[model samples]
Target: MEYDVVVLGAGPTGENVADRTRAAGLSTAVVEGELVGGECSYWACMPSKALLRPVIAGSDARRVPGLRQAVGGPLGTEAVLAHRDEMTSHWKDDGQVSWLDGIGARLYRGQGRLHGPRRVVVEGPEGEHHVLTARHAVAVCTGSRAALPDLPGLNGARAWTSREATSAHAAPRRLVVVGGGVVGTEMATAWQGLGSQVTLLVRGQGLLPRMEPFVGEHIAKSLTEAGATVRTGVGVAAVNRPDPGGPVTVVLDGGELIEADELLFATGRAPRTDDIGLDTVGLQPGSWLSVDDSCRVDGHDWLYGVGDVNRRALLTHQGKYQARIAGAAIVARARHCPLLETDRWGAHAATADHDAVPQVVFTDPEAAAVGLSLAQARAAGHRVRAVDKDLAAIAGASLFVDDYRGRARMVVDLDRQIVLGVTFVGPGVSELLHSATIAVAGEVPIDRLWHAVPSYPTISEVWLRLLEGYRDGADGGDGTDDGADGGDGTDGDTDGTDGRGGRGQGG
Candidate 1:
């Protein structure tokens, strides 16, 4: 078989790359050994979010006085699992395959590896060998896998990764989560809300160490209040499970033992390049591929690496963004046209990968952030100011929940007077992230942002408060200050003790 482009994985990144190539009138082929929609569709994003929605909704309802009494019951676990099945198409990939067919891309079901240069060979299910040659480009979008530490007896313990945690038919009564990053915290949140007694063990000082310090603090507080035991500054020493289906006993570093029905290790992710025939191309196996701004692999114009394999932003949306850029670049190169301006935000450049990646963690009081955090900006040698405001001070937030506990912060570059990054940790803040993403990505100036006013009595009013705080500090001749004291300046009843009578009707 021959194609203009051959994508090595059928994940979201690969799918999008193939989509763009076929749209450019190029024949594309996608090969996968598993389901077509890949991990995000079946195991990571879809199933996890489906399991989290009801839990979050129930939490939100509990925060409202009138609705609190109505939700004082256990979740409909069976219904939620069934809906998750529906969202993942019951673990089938026929629909995704059809979508590829409709787009005129060939779907090959097998294990694919690079033979050499532009050549690929696939070993099919029935021991049949198929060779595919890419005329223009080959994109490796194999994504990543869970990285587990080499703990004694861990392999035989039948522990869960993100896959097993998200796709399990039944929730374990006792669940012990390892790691403190997004996967660990999120899975802990989901299982705890779904009626599991979750114990989250973090080897670090706190959760989400990469984000703002307050983010981890707030989440730890919420998780503790919600009946999950979050233990930080601890490491798992060993695992013992004589029977795969039986309970597992975990030994912590200080000889403390904890038993749980199931164990989940969300430590980290490693690139999926170990067995993808990177050796044939003179690239190291199991190593992350370095790519240019156009996502073409370093030193290989005809080879591209998108998604987690490239070591860019590891989020699904970021991968899709890179896929679009890489796809366009490939098509342009094949047409013998000058790659459309490779500058930042150019037609073929993935500028956002550097300074505008956005992420949302759907835990209680959902945490969303984009671009650089305060620490990151400081470390990068940027003169930045951080302005923070209490989310409960927003009228819409009061109307949303009785005592909405959240905070919003914006980091501004002093020289440019534009937002470097924004972080929102509160209820319903996920939807507000794109505004900040656009502001940072577009390099919108602070003065111009002030003119783009937020509506009154809305959670978005927090933006107004943040900007007001920044301006006030500037007017007072305190350049690049940290407005950490909720910044509203009213000073009266700022702790949300006032009744929620003056807010908008709905959240």
Candidate 2:
């Protein structure tokens, strides 16, 4: 056997697994044909945030130092894109290669397929063949690609995916988007900031339907205010890209034709688990090596799958989380160490994946949430209560934007007295997610969380306000704890006494 572990696709998750396995004193080999950092590092999150960070800085700049603009100014589109490419090493795959070598894991630049249990056949980039036999495990972490919709004329025309939009050097005069999900919304925000006349066509009533409605509402407002036209409940009927810089016309089902220089499909992603030799190992597409809390691939206990390839939630963080656990699981199996488990860690073992995977849309008035929404929670048979606040009323928002207009919400499990979910949508609120995530994951009781105080004048103060409102509303004109609110703090987030002081203010 060449090694103890063989990991396919050297994306972030794959790299993590390889690194972890190596640290456990096991020989590991990583196979890759593309950049190791994967989509998020090169195209999606890194560059997208690069574009937004400047807009945020410029907003602060124009607000304080330079006068006469509501922070609306061109952000040197070409320069910003050039910087993005530079950060990505001009889409070069070498930077990742160097990192892989530094980690002491063997690297194979090739197309890899499972020949059988513990065996893989690799077709190298230069057409060389190598067979690897793993003494312990083989893992699939292939990630995913943009899912294309079967819209008429979609393929026949010059359309873009998240890949093109994120790495494109040239900016279009007008841009039309086909989906209103996270990728679509964030790309729309980036392009709009970079001076593209942007139009978003959504199939739902609002963008970000998966996040809370409050989040969707705030994103719609912020995008609209920033001069982007959003049309919902409309799917593209057809596309026609006839000539150079000619308008790409998307005929709507409702007899409307939208024109733009370029069209982008921000539809969701599909796992890249095809033709990787799953069948030889008794695996199927949807059933590709199912695992338990130990992430052990079913049937073949030594085989593992991670990242977007498992048809799991396609977030980079989730991928890395799975990789870390898988690596540790490998170590545990080798040393006969009792498996270390946590909800967010070993939780990768089953179909309960969505129990609390946090999703964030990094737009202006950024939206983020974890766990189930109100409807989802109720349908899952939990008595639910929700508290929503116009962020404008929170000290956090008032301090951040003086004329603040944002939205937030917290969902509580009445029986559990813990936050099942929470959301924040506004400028500079990205860092506020950990509190909610910790609360939900830990299932922290409402009262104990009161001791987990948020610093003053921060957006997290909204957490205190949300608990207070739920407590007040649950009082029902009389203070009583019938476990009625089932809120994260409906019973104890606030002291029953009305003494709202001692959280001294800070910016």
Candidate 3:
């Protein structure tokens, strides 16, 4: 079978790619070995958030004065899991498949591998082989999987990765989570709230090392306060499980041993390119595919890499963003039209992946940030200022959560007077991140931001406080001008754990 586009992996990224290509009247085919909706829908984003919402809601309820009494009991774990299962369509992809069919994209059910340039060979579940050829472009969107550490006794041990952590039938009595990234912290929060005694072991100095130093501090404090053991500067050396489904014994680097009913290695992500037959196309089978800004593979005009497989911004939303760009580029090239708007913030270019990528880590006190951090701006040689405001000072925050503990930081480019990045680490702050993303990506001027007033008495009021602080500090005009805005644009987008983005992508 030949198509204008053949997409490997039917995740959100692949679906969007096929959707766009087919909308452009290009024949598109999508192949998947797992559920059609991919990781975000089945495991990472959707189900995980489903598990987290109740926890967050309960926590929020407890913070409010009158509502606290009603929610003073443990979360119904059975109901929570059931709700999550429902949100994921009970792991069935029928709806997703139907949506694909509606979009006029062919769905090939199998394990697909690149047979050669612009060619994909899929081995169906029953070992049937089907060769698919792409007339215009072959897109690789296999996404990523948990990267387990090479530890002894791990193979036999029934360890939980993100998938198992989110989909388990019941919460374990004790959960040990390794890695301090988004998955580790979020899952730790979810299970701990659902009545599990969570022990979060981090090899680094603190949680969320990629964000501001205070972010890790705040999350660690809250996690500890919530009856979870937050231990930092600890490394896992080995795993010992005598029998499957038995207890897991994790050995630390200094010979310390910890026992848990379940162990989750939220260590990191590895590209799902290993078995995709990349070697057949002269590329390393296990390596990440490099792509240009349009998500097209390097040195291959007919090849495109979208989503986590390309190692570009790894967040699902970012992957979808890349897919749109890739699709547009594909359509433009195939139709012999001028590839206009390939520039930054253009319809055909994914400029947001560079700095305006937004992420929300759904812990009790959500952590969200976009654009650059103070350290990132300094390293990038931008003359910037970091202005911080205590969210407790905002009246809306106090009304939202009694004794609200959160901080907001705004990083501004001094020379240009434009906001480089913004971060809000507190309860209900996730809703405030998109404004920051717009400010950074649009390069909105600080003086202009002062006029874009936040609604009165909302968590968004923190924006006003930050702007006032920035203005007050600037007014002082002391001889020492540390007045550079505080905020850091992460080197990699999506908190470095969820999504991966490379420098370039092509369609």
Best by lDDT: 1
The C-alpha local distance difference test score for the whole of candidate 2 amounts to: 0.72
- Provide the lDDT at 438 for model 2: 85
- TM-scores, in order shown? 0.94, 0.88, 0.94
Give candidate 2's error at residue 224 in angstroms: 1.5
Using alpha carbons, what is the TM-score of model 2?
Answer: 0.88
lDDT digits (tens) for residues 1-507 of candidate 1: 899999999888888899899999999999898878777888887788888899999999998988999999999999999998887878877777777788899988899999899989999888898899999999999988888899998989999998899899998999999988888888888889999999999998888876777787889999999999999989999999998778999999999999999999988888989988999999999999999999999999799999888877778788888889999999999999998579989989999988998988888879998998887787788877888888988999998888899988898988889999898998899999999999999999999998888887779888898899898776423233453421211110000000011110000
Query: For model 2, how many clashes?
Result: 3
For candidate 3, lDDT tens digit of each residue in 1-507? 999999999888888898899999999999999888787777777778888999999998898999989999999999999988887778777777878888899999999999988899999999999999999999999988988889888888889999898889999999999988889999999999999999999988778776877887899999999999999989988999897767999999999999999999898788999999898888998889998889888989899888888776678878888999999999999999887898888888888888788888899899998887788778888877788788898899899978889988887788888888787889999899888988999998888888898888788978777777778777433111233333242322132222111101111
lDDT of 2 by residue, 233-309 (tens): 88777777777456788888877888888889887776677768887877775343456554567676788888666
- Single out the weakest 10-residue window by summed lDDT for candidate 1: 491-500
TM-score (C-alpha, index-matched) for candidate 3: 0.94
Candidate 3 residue 149 C-alpha distance from true site, Å: 1.0
Q: Residue 429's C-alpha lDDT in candidate 1? A: 92
The models' CA-based lDDT, in order, is 0.85, 0.72, 0.84
Output the better candidate (2/3) by TM-score. Answer: 3
